[model samples]
Target: MNLAKNRNEIDPKFKWDIEKIYADTETWNKEFQEIKTLAPKLKEYEGKLNNAETLYEFLQLEEKVSRKLYLLLIYAFLKSDEDTTQNQYQALKSKIQAFAAEFGSYVSFMNPELLSLPEGTMEKFLEEKEELKLYKFMIEDLLRNKPHVLSQKEEALLASAEDIFGAPQNIYNIFSNADLKFPQITNEEGEKVDFTESSYFKYIISKNRDVRKEAFEALFGTYESFKNTIATSLTASTKKFAFMAKTKKFNSSIEYALSPLNIPVSVYDNLIETINNNLNLLHRYVDVKKKLLGVDELHMYDLYVPVIDVPDMHIEFQEGVDMVKEGIKPLGEEYLNIFQEGIDNRWIDVYENKGKRNGAYSWGSYDTMPYVLLNYNFKYNDVSTLAHEMGHSLHSYYSRKEQPFVYSNYTLFCAEVASTVNECLLINDRISKETDKKKKLYYINEQLEQIRGTVFRQTMFAEFERETHKLIDAGTPLTSEELNDIYYNLNKKYYGDKMVIDDLIKVEWARIPHFYRDFYVYQYSTGYSAAMSFTSAILRDGEEAVERYKGFLKSGGSDYSINILKKAGVDMTTTKPVQDTMDRFKELLDMLEAEL
Candidate 1:
């Protein structure tokens, strides 16, 4: 295989043409200077929100500054992800951070001023000014936090703590993706292959136990070595959260987390309970793995071997595009057309290369067409991955086409729904079209793997996060030992019965970067459950469901996220969607058992 390369010759597919962001560096520099000059003028509105004209003027200038700042940051990330070692890209990253900090210095008064208004004055302001009505939600989001909104001096003090709070994510990224190393393993054919960070999952899923053992030991052993340092950084991150929540008068860290998105604690509880009850089915799947592999006992590392051999699932690039198109057809013609437009244009960079960003994502700006970056290997999983990323691209296209500037960007909480819906539909299509018994079984198990990884495993991570934060909120110190104990115990609860709950698994919490991000992992579980319900609804109702889902894609951040999801038909406030998804897991287990 000629494969791909990004070192000497950049694969056209792996490299995004960021020239679209701004024709070149010269244009970006010009815009950067213009935005910097505009920043100082924002101070003109420091004490003047009572005057609509002044407020509107400040907002317009602020918008321009923000748009330019966005362009700079996107370019820096694109360039950095392409190759993190580039000094040019690294310099821009720091420069942008400094500019953001400086910009914060100027506009720090905006939120404070809004909260200072008389209780009902903002409602009247929205009614009076046509321009202000467009920003009504933005204004009220501040007022909603008036109780927690701090004074200017205190807010400034907290704002200066950004880097301290960001330390965990930074440290984890450096160690995991860019720094960690794994030992070489001898495969069944006696060929020695060294493991890279990108190869961790691939190696773990190998049919050979020796390969799995070597990879698991090497990968996690590295983490265990650095456990102390990683634990300290994570503990400090928890302190940052504890401090913020306490100062803001929230009862607990979980309350502070759910309050932002208007989600309830019960939603989290329901997810954990639903998964806990379904573990017998999951354990049954693990038992099947043990029998198939003929292992006396199953370990965590042996979980990924393919039980059913899938034949000729090797799709060419064009065939992958066609499959994604057919799978997403139910999303209606308009949504599909916009998605097709992105594919037809050079909006996607679709192959792997050395030093290219790991994993995949759909990204673009309000000013640009939605674009996807993928590291394609043409495996069956790649086909599903294509559908997943395109789900996000199409969502971005529709959202940008419909929503105004302020509302154009949606929250991370709703981000996975569009992507996962596409994945589910693609899997359903593959299972329907592929007729060979073994191949179909392989596809079914692949779908099962999605539930195992995304729904069940992530919920476990969510539980761990919630538990750790609760400890922190209670004024408990989160030492490395304490974190290890909490993490190892949860590992036992989730995977203990079937697979050995190795003591080494305790270090896993130290390495998980998501713990630094308050209340993020649960979204994967909630989003997967919601997508399953949406997928079933679309299949049964067809056009009407497609139209509503399309409406959801276009909604962007125009409405509250909870309200937006409800309009699209799945509500997170209740547990119906999650229960339905868990039932599907049971059904899938039955099908697999029949095959056995």
Candidate 2:
């Protein structure tokens, strides 16, 4: 019955400790000044990088400044996310962003200069300097984009343009997060409540039909009104990516986006093709939902609220943590110990307050403890989110502890795999233990929805991204009408014949912020598929699998994403992972059908 509370109203224990990164604002500002001062020093090593010993020292200094910059930026961003309306943190975040661009501009000469060195120069340098060997993988990653490095002046120009190119996402964030307003909707109790971005999901999942319909219309209706402006913003972002990619000599933006992570176009293509091949599974899930809800036709708004409601299902935050702990036990005690340390250390911002960010993420630098942001609503799904984010945190913890700072961060290609694997384990554990029939059905619904959203829906998103980029690549203008047609047709194809494809659903493409990110959503599909393999291995093979999985976590950017996943027992080059994931999906559907 309560709405969002003020930040002060939330318990300090539930809030993450930003002070852990910096003791106070003074300390943050001090580090901010230090990074600014360090920014100009990169020029000192501009021409000196060709010398093996000099390059080694320069790399060390670069790492030192990089670590400090990341910590400062993370603190400012996390603080701002806690209360986005706070102008103090907002200014600090902007200051950091500007500083980051300057820093990037200063360091831009390094790669181009290194590439300018004779081709075998790197190999000779690595052979000569022992310290340079530490950066072998790093140097290789840099040289891998040798074709795209451009001249020193050109690279600096591009680097300095970073802030200019970020205008669209920044504009979108401002509109969606701070400015956009939803109309108030009457709830199940006939009480008027203001709908918000954060509350939109909660309302959609409400047991009441009226609440879901009203909230859906109120949310997307606002988007519909602003569709023209939103369309322009998204189109600008798409063009920016296309321009950058073509400037760098890549064929398309998707290749530019995926190449750095060593992901091939075929992997992206295979994910789409495999998902399309299994569209029947998604359609089957939709049919099951329609039957369960007893609706003659399911509307787009009717998709979220579960068909089975468990009245006593309100799970406390602490209970969710405990559930995650037990669910991840198959990963062995050492893994759990590190996870427990993170849980005990206030590494999570556990509840939502006014102006807080809507979704969940695990974020931190190599220099800091892994931190998670969650807006816990005390539902069973929150527990799954907890488990998912903990997976990310643990991945960071292991990577940071094992690899050097340069190799600490993993790519989006492999990032979601760990999180989804944890979700699989958590849902599997809950489903196996539940005794009540309705509650079991509810859990099954939750699991199926996870697959529905992650595997099917995200692949659908992936295809949209691919198609839109291709359209731009082929010199076709992306008008709002064309974007809508593409999105609605795909929506219809994925959802199949059981549901009513509302006209308003066509406007949904204008609202997805990820479209601005350029080919980012496909990883959720691929990562989920890879995670299915790891989850099956962990459950069936036990300790050996856990150790291999641990190795994969620690590998980080030490190797390419595919190789890392391969070492972790998932061979993504073949369609086997996707097919195996579909098998798991059907197996769950069988269980849900038997339970019903």
TM-score, one value per model:
0.89, 0.88
Cα lDDT tens digits for candidate 1, 1-596: 24656544864544567788878667877888888887898887888877777777788888888777888878767766666657777777788889988988898788788787778988887777798888988887767778887777888788788787787778778877787766787766779987786788887777777888887787788788888888888878888888889998888888888887777788888888888887777777787777877888887777777767667667887888898888877877876787777776767777766667778888878887676777777887888888898888888888888988889998887899999999888888877787677877887788888898888889989988888888888888877788888888887777648777766778878666777788889999998998998998898899999888888889999877878888999888787788778877777777777776
Model 1 C-alpha RMSD to native: 3.4
- Candidate models: Cα lDDT each: 0.80, 0.88
Q: In each prediction, how many residue pairs overlap at the backbone (N, C-alpha, C within less than 3 A)?
A: 0, 0
Give candidate 1 regions above 4 Å deviation: 5-21, 24-26, 71-102, 165-199, 218-233, 309-312, 352-358, 477-482
**Which parts of model 2 have CA positions greater than 4 angstroms off?**
1-39, 73-102, 156-203, 206-233, 314-318, 345-360, 374-377
Residue lDDT tens for model 2, 1-596:
13688999988888888888998778999888888888688778878887898998888888888999999899999999999989999999999999888888777667778899987899899999987899898888888899887887887788789999999999999999999988999998999998897898988988888899998899888988998888888888999999999999998888899888888888989989988999898888888888998889899999998787764767888788899988888989998898888877899998889999899999999988799999999887788899999999999999999998888989878989888889889888888998988888878877788888888988999899889889888888988888889999999999998889988888898778888888888888898999988898999999999989999999988999999989888889889889888988888889988988
RMSD of each: 3.4, 3.6
Top-lDDT structure, candidate number: 2
